[model samples]
Target: MNADLIIAGAGPAGLFSAVQAAENNENKKIIILEKNSSAGKKLLISGSGQCNLTHAGDISQFFDHYGENYNFLMGPLYTFDNHQLMKFFKDRGIKFRKARGGKIFPESNKASDILNVLLKEAKARGIKIIYNTPVENVKYKTGRFKIKTADKIYKSKYFLLAAGGKSFPRTGSTGDGFQIASSLGHNIIEPQPALAPVIIKNYQFKMLSGISLKNKEVSLWRKENLIKSWSGDLLLTHQGLSGPGIINYSRYMQKGDIIKVMLLNYSKEELENNLLKKIEREGKLNLLNLLIKFPIAQRLIEKILEIAEIDGSQNAAHLTRQERKEIIEIFSNLEFKIKSLANFNQSMVTKGGIDLSEINPQNMESRIISNFFAAGEVLDIDGDTGGYNLQAAFSTAFLAGSELKERL
Candidate 1:
């Protein structure tokens, strides 16, 4: 083998993997091949550039954020969990701060600082990283894997495939690794757009194009059937809708499915109770005026009233019980016809990657191809925003680096 280790991609996972290998193994020759001119381009924009490096909490909590199959990360978490990762950064002079929701951002609040630290550490440990060199193919035969770049070919005793997914294409995650993994004996889970925003039905969303709802609950209904619900800040976009709430439900969205939205997020009976209280508290207010309690624009309130058949000019005190009941219904369950999803520009992260079943979770190594490990968004694992994905990248890379070094 020309090199002991050759890691693909230079995002969070690949950079960290190369760093760890170089840091702990002084005797081995480690090389990282990055397609970008510099390392960690996509990483530089994570956490809105503050770079949520890792989470600061129990391993179970970390596992909880990953999804239903938390066990897929048990080995990785134990090997390089948040505590260990934080310590790793601290030792390298990269200070970090704990943000809301267990997220830990760099104290400098510049993702570049995090990337700089990792790159510097790798360079200091005698690791050679070549940039602007895209890997054309990876061919495995005779118990060895061969990697070919544009200008050169290299063979490594061990390989870590950390190329990212197709989200945020400019970040260098183009989903090329998925095809390469499939060419080997791995099965892909049919990658789809995940963590993207939803386009609400034109009827209800057209009026409130720029309004925002904060701390309000949001529910996703598919054809009158409530599929999922999430609550956070909601942003009215130029096209339709976005926000933490809708983005959370995007994981379950399928093609040809229409997702409905409920702005009030109040239960059927709770709707009735809140409506009556509004009438009792402000009897002289008009129906359009009463809707100010919800976080929409007054003009939007008027439009909603028009939809509900409530007289915008009529006094709340004169509202009939039936009118109030209908108003409550509209507020409680505002149907949004889900048209489609926002593209890569609107998404925070990509959902699907390499099928998890094809890789050994313990070391992120491909089961069919010896010494070929996979990590980060390139694998069939993705998490929500607020630093979850960064943590996954770091954890899986840590495991792959350390575990692969053991056999050497």
Candidate 2:
């Protein structure tokens, strides 16, 4: 079989790219090969089935969520930003709602609705979609690309590898794109788990499993050096911590790293001053009662007191200065040793893939092979939770699709 463009993987990037490329040049024969039974398997599970389509904000603000490779996304995002993305869906009769932190979602709150829009658009463009047809190998020679699948060999003038990352193997994103790109001479970065939970060593907050703290400060420390800090809501799980705050920062963490959580809003000196004022104002009150005034849960406070070796029954007036300092330190800087990060099966996205340096940021075309392109998590571009990663996929795919004619 021959086509003007042969796109591997029918995920977000492949679907969007096929539709966009068809729209740009309707004369071209575009086909998308999907390994799964249907398209958008990963999309169906994104945002817990609600599907955070894109974030509503300035393009510059969206750049920060991508970390160090923020500049590489400038071209793609600016070309087809979140605003354009929302508009595309809205024009297709998809109603959207903006939730907290500017996350945009379909009003129906179903991921299937988002997939339906992409499928509808692709179908309208007369794009051929081959389901359950996984491409086994790809070869480029004489300016034509040959793709080998289970039943037959396919040829295309332009090839797009949008098979996604290895985060969710069950969804069919088993790092096949990485292997295909590597075979084509593109460098692949070591893929790691991202947007996943971290395990705590000997977790003391197990009793407070369901307790969730909002607007708390979580910091990552490596051997006494503060690496990074994030402020958001954190949930105390039975094994460790799991929440937007902890999961967002888990990308930079590893086993044996230190996670310091600030249970109180006040600084160390401010906390000590407040404790001293409490001792003076309520001298007859017990230590536990005095400590309960903070925003933290009572059980957590009790654990802190126990860790400090301070008797909760002791009156505030009877507490020594050393005991007061210990309490202050516990509240201002609670530390936990990280045991390990959740594996890819539980991760939202894969951290590493094809290194961004080897790809043309303007169009997402491979620097090593002309007419070969890539997008989505297959590249070394993972973002913080809240619709950032999906936007990257769309933006990069749009750019690559728009430039498909030039390569052809």
Residues 1-408, model 1: lDDT tens digits: 388888888888998888766766888888888999988888888878888877777877777566555678888887777888888878978787888777889888998988888878887888888899888999887877799988899898788888888888887778788877877778887766677877755546565677887766666655567676666777777677677666755777764565444566678798788778888999789767777876666776787777776788888889987887777666665656667777776677777777787778888887787788888888877676666778788889988877776765
Residue by residue across 1-408, what tens digits does model 2's lDDT show? 999999998999999988888885767789999999999999999999999999888888988788677888999999999999989888999999999988999999999998999999998888999999998999999989999999999998799999999898999989899999999998888999998888899887788888888999888998888888889888889889889988877779989899888888899988888888888999899989987987778988887788778999989899998888888787888888999998899889998899899999999888888889998989999898999999999999999988885554
Q: Which candidate number has the best lDDT? A: 2
* lDDT value, candidate 1, whole model: 0.77
lDDT of each: 0.77, 0.90
- Which regions of candidate 2 fall more than 4 Å away from where they truly are? 405-408
> Which window of 10 residues has the lowest lDDT sum in candidate 2?
399-408
**TM-score attained by model 1:** 0.92
Highest TM-score model number: 2
User: Which residue pairs of candidate 1 clash?
Assistant: 201-337
